[model samples]
Target: MQTIWAPWRITYILGEKEQGCFLCQKARQVEHDEENFVLCRKTHAFVLMNVYPYNNGHLMIAPYAHVSSLTELHHDQLEDMFRLAQLCESVLTLVMQPEGFNIGINLGKVAGAGVEDHLHLHIVPRWNGDTNYMTTIADTRIIPQQLEETCELLRSGFLLEQKER
Candidate 1:
């Protein structure tokens, strides 16, 4: 039998899943900025690094409102989500230098929404040869960077964007 060790995933395996909406809680709680991995917070929406990511710079932009459906959001909230999504794209390009990206919104559980109770957009960075033996053969992904490093790297990009404005 082939054995692969992913010690980092042990924390996730043993950790307790929190009650309530994790995204909503993270949106309001700024106390644990780095712990929460929040890169940038806007009026109606915020950009945060995915604790569990498909790629290094994976991010999600969500509105502060608790509404799940896209139609339930106010016009400005929808606008903020899009604005932040665009910012996430630029940030990923600058920090990760990915060849491409996969950006989308999963509305319902049936539609692959991890947090179906809150609406958000997922931005997954991709590269030409990012896929390798680990993902293809071992059925696991190896993120080359830690979450903190990713957050800090993307945060710098966001800060640079702010300065340019």
Candidate 2:
């Protein structure tokens, strides 16, 4: 197996444990969409670009209320969460159409929920050979574009569409 280098993972090393709820913290902060990478905010849910994306335009639609279990969400929140996910796909198709996608939620710690306190639906854009030898053999992921660039592009489209409407 060839060794693959991914320098970006270092950004997550220090202070990761000290960090609290990312979704709540970002929503409370003073920043533009490009800074926060927030796409849309609904009554019960909101969409945001993944700070660490599996691909260039990866996104997550999450309920505002922090809950680990799928059954823990109020009916309206669950509906709005999936609805926002659909909207995310719609926007991604319009702006950054990939060949395919990976969408799901991991409910618990063992199930791979990085933030088990809050539920977020992941929308990962996929293409042929996306899961190549690097992931399986080398334990690395090669994402071509920077998260900030992707954030800027998505936020621009979202803001433009909002203004048009």
Candidate 3:
């Protein structure tokens, strides 16, 4: 497998355990939603806008627990993760109206997980013709929307729906 190692990932790998856990930290700091690009927080997981996305409105839903493998998670955690993923898809569709999405988890380090300490599902909003010559020819992916705007749209949509419930 071809590994793409970025300089920032080193921090995740070498971080102290006393920091508790990164995923848990995000879960705990609920008030930092806007700054953190966190759209919604469910019982077992949360959805956040991807700061660096393959496309606009790209997001990720992850378990609150800091587990590396899917099998290591409890049934409730797995269920909630999928539930959040489903809701994330709905919110993205409602707000961005994308043609489709790329939703799944990269299980391990070799499989392109930037945070190997936690398992998260990437919900990447996609569109027809979104991939262009830039990616193939220029080796670059263009995201048309800002992360803050995407997060605001998703967060408002999610909060509105929550109010309905």
Candidate 4:
């Protein structure tokens, strides 16, 4: 059997899970944006990198409201979320140059929603040959870049894009 060393995962495995919604916590803590990996914030929504990402430039666009369903959001919130999704795609494309993107929302826990209570859209950047045998054979996905480094790149990209707008 081949062993893969993922030393960082131990923090999540052994650390005590904080009470209350993590998304809400992150949303409220605007001062801690860098520590929380928040790339951009809009009037009604924000964009941040996925700590447990499926790919290198994976991002999530979420509203400030802590509603489980999209129906609960006002039209402005929904619009803001979608606009942030576009921003995520643009920033990722500029920084990572992905060939394509997979963008969608998982509504429930059974639907692959990691934070089901707060509806968010995922923007996963893809490239040719990004998926390898390790995914099917070992049931593991490899992310090439460090989360902090990716966050820095994406954050810079977002700033540059927004400034040009």
lDDT of 3: 0.79
- RMSD (CA, Å), candidate 3 to true, equals 5.9
Query: Which sequence of candidate numbers ranks them by TM-score, best first?
Result: 4, 1, 2, 3
Location of the lowest summed lDDT over 10 successive residues in candidate 4? 1-10
The 10-residue segment with the lowest total lDDT in model 2: 26-35
- Candidate maximizing lDDT: 4
After superposition, candidate 1 runs with Cα above 4 Å error: 1-3
lDDT of 1 by residue, 30-138 (tens): 8887788888888899888888899889898889899889899998999889988888888788877889999999999999998899988999999998889888877
Evaluation by TM-score, superior candidate among 1 and 2: 1
Whichever of 3 and 4 has more lDDT, that candidate is: 4
Clashing pairs in model 4, backbone N/Cα/C closer than 3 A = none
**Model 3 Cα lDDT, one tens digit per residue, 1-165:** 544344544654796554555566777888887776788877888887766678888788888887899999999999999988778877788888988889888987899988888888898888899999879976867666556666778877787667766
**Which clashing pairs does model 1 show?**
none
Tens-digit lDDT track of model 2 for 21-88: 98777656536545677888878888888877777798998888878778889899988898777777
RMSD in angstroms, all models? 1.5, 2.6, 5.9, 1.1
Model 3 misplaced regions, further than 4 Å: 1-22
Global CA lDDT computed for model 1: 0.87
lDDT: worst 10-residue window of model 1: 2-11
